[model samples]
Target chain A: MSDLSRLSLNQATIKYAGMEQAVSACLRAEIPGIGLWREPVAEYGLRKTGALLRQAGLTPTSMCRGGFFTSPDSDQRIKDLADNRAAVDECAELGVPELVLVSGGLPDGSRDVDGARSMVLDSLAELAPYAGERGVRLAIEPLHPMFCSDRCVVATLGQALDLASRFPAEQVGVVVDTYHIWWDPTVYQAIERAEGRISAFQVCDWITPLPAGVLLGRGMMGDGCIELRRMREAVDKAGYTGPIEVEIFNQEIWDADAMEIAELTAARYVEHVL
Target chain B: MSDLSRLSLNQATIKYAGMEQAVSACLRAEIPGIGLWREPVAEYGLRKTGALLRQAGLTPTSMCRGGFFTSPDSDQRIKDLADNRAAVDECAELGVPELVLVSGGLPDGSRDVDGARSMVLDSLAELAPYAGERGVRLAIEPLHPMFCSDRCVVATLGQALDLASRFPAEQVGVVVDTYHIWWDPTVYQAIERAEGRISAFQVCDWITPLPAGVLLGRGMMGDGCIELRRMREAVDKAGYTGPIEVEIFNQEIWDADAMEIAELTAARYVEHVL
Candidate 1:
């Protein structure tokens, strides 16, 4: 059996709940790790949120996101870089292991995805050293292809590993989220390539006959069709002995009681995924 | 400028309209080509639909779909192969140049995408002779990765082309559709690789920040943010001189009058895409 204590709850799983409540619920459930987003951190004020997490004796696995590198203008790209630098600073303050980077989509009024990816690489290279100096690791999260146009340009595990390979291992890496990469044929091989550089391992399930819009149907663990045990085996083979973070973005789960959701997520991890 | 007479109206654009009405509207609009779906053809009676298209002087560009080879049982796989053979016969009877094939997603209760893909390739190899004998070319259409779990397993243009390269060009080829593949960084290179083997070329825009619960939000030529001109340039440079078929699956267009939608689609193709 896997270690249930390594389970981390991403706050977006219960985004309908306030940040303090989510932190408190994680403590109540004895979930050792938590992943946070900028909005909630800002809403609660970082210092207070950090103190509360410290009080709850929870370690932050990662800071939710940073990096929308593709933009129509150099000025916008520079602005994004500056914003990411600030995100890096925030990660350093939070003492998180990694800052999840979601490479932004096609630039406005631009149709060249290759060009947008080039911009992303250049921005990552520029941001890496600053982040490295601050002891903050950058974790590129390859979102599912559904978000290719508007959310993130990096859309597969192989693609993320390819990008990460371009930079030093300590400067850049990848987050293997089952929600985003469970469908990739090259996922296992990509995981093997990311062995030592595997920054985060996120878990979620994919539901069938996805409703008209593909974004809102992310299923919670055990609720959908993904074989969590198989994925865990792949991660284990890849030598990634890290926190198995549950980062579900389900509409139904978000509206339920925060504490209840956390406890149920913990129990589900123990019964199904672990 | 693109050849306006080479424009093909995929019937799914105005899905709410009956097959006969869509064909009549396209003929009236002086559109030279039409792509048919099996459901509408079966509903309207294939003979009636075929006779109407002939009577109206509209050329069938290609069949809308034919492959969903992944299944839980050997019986279903065999059945899928037989169904594909039938679809090939339909395409040949309709004088269509190619039958579009969408590799099916993961098998029922299975998450092995590689296994599903291997099943698709094996099914294709089995069906290729039947299709070739009927004078029907199989055009593999790679769907967006979002469909990898439920709809189609072929998720990238390069992946589709790579699969096609495994067989004889006369038996297997690729359908390069902008909406499904525009996000790929290697799309331009893939199109170049597909030079003489591109059986079909499709056009549709990719809209951003799509509404919730909608997976098939295909934008019209100028509606969404895809770089249609650049994509057309790549297709042209790659030595493809085929008709650019407009295949939008937008609810907004489907809800409109068939004739009006046809007219607007033609105008948009000329104004923005051509």
Candidate 2:
């Protein structure tokens, strides 16, 4: 049986919940770890939030998002780098070892995805060392291909690993989210290949007839067609003993009470994933 | 300049038009060919439709679609095969050499994509010889990965090519549709690898803020962000000299007058695709 002790809640799942409430909910529900978003950390004051989680005996599993180096404008690129550097500092301040990076999409009026990808690699070359110095690994999260043109150029776990492979496994890794990589034919092989560099394993079921904007369609566990158990098994077999973060983005779920949602997520994780 | 002589109007782009009107409109516009859908041809009397198009000197580029064998139920699978066989017969009667196949999604209550994919291959094995004997090639059109669960298990051009490679190039081939494949990072390499096996080249741009159903979100050419010209150039370089069929599925376009839509599609084809 898969381990339930490592279950983590990404703050986005309960979109309306503040960091204090989310961390408290996780602690109350015995969800050992929680993934932090930069906005929430900023809102709560990073140092205070870190102390709150630590005081409550909660682990900060991973940090959400620090990568948007695809801008064609040099000034924008410089600003993005500064923001990313600040994100790295935030990771260190929060005592989280992994910083999740969602590489930005293509530049304005540019259809050059290759150029965007090259910028990601180039930025990583500059930032990985900085992150490594601060003892925080950067985890590249590959968003689904549906978001390729606007949200993320890295649309597959294999592509994430390809980029991550350029840096040391200690400094860079990949995030395997079932919602994003479930449709990939070679995902199992990619998971096996990801072995050591699998920094975070995120779970979110995929339901179709996607709503407008496509961002809020991530269904809760056991709610969609994704093989949650199968994906969990693959990640487990890949030798990843890290926390499995539940990171859903559905609107209706977010409208519910935070504690109720946390309990439901835990039950679903046990039944459908663990 | 790209050859407009090879341009074909996929009937879906002008969904409001009857087969007779579509054929007449193509002829009026000096368009060389048309890709047809089964429902209209069946409604118009297949043989009569074929005769009408032939008399109008319009080539029958391809027939739209015949593959939905992902049902877990044996009876449904049998029915799907029967329907596909009937579609192949219709292809012969319509004088269309290519029959597009959108392999259906996961079976009910099942999340096994691998199992669904195997069913596709098995169904293809049964249908390929039947199609080949009828002088038709089954063109596996991989829908975007977003549709993998509910529409098609064949979700990548590479996966389509892999399946097609198992059969003779004359009997089985791949359809390269820009709307479905524009997000694929390895698409250009897949196009290069699809040399001599590309049965059809379909064009449609992809616009963001996908609609509620995400089905009718295909943009008119040049309105969205796809590198349509690059994809056209890739297909041409890959030795696919077949008709370039415009196949958009936007509801707004469908509500417009058929002749106006056809003219706009042709103009867009010349400006954005060719």
Considering every candidate listed, which one attains the maximal lDDT?
2
Off-target runs (Cα >4 Å) in candidate 1 are A73-78, A208-214, B43-48, B211-215
Residue-by-residue lDDT tens digits, candidate 2, A1-274: 4355989999999979998899878977789999999998898898899889889989999999899879989898899999999999999988898999999988777778788999999999989999999999999999999999898999999889999999999999999999999999999999999999998999989997799888899998887889889988999999999999999998899999999999888989999999
lDDT of 2: 0.91
TM-score of 2: 0.98
Q: For all the predictions, what are the DockQ values?
A: 0.46, 0.73
Candidate 1: lDDT of A200? 91
lDDT string, candidate 2, B20-68, tens digits: 8898778766688899999998899988998898788999899998998
Clashes of 2: 0
Question: Would candidate 2 be rated incorrect, acceptable, medium or high by CAPRI criteria?
Answer: medium
C-alpha RMSD in Å of predicted model 2 compared with the true structure:
1.4
Q: On a 0 to 1 DockQ scale, where is model 1?
A: 0.46
Could you list the chain B TM-scores for each candidate? 0.96, 0.97
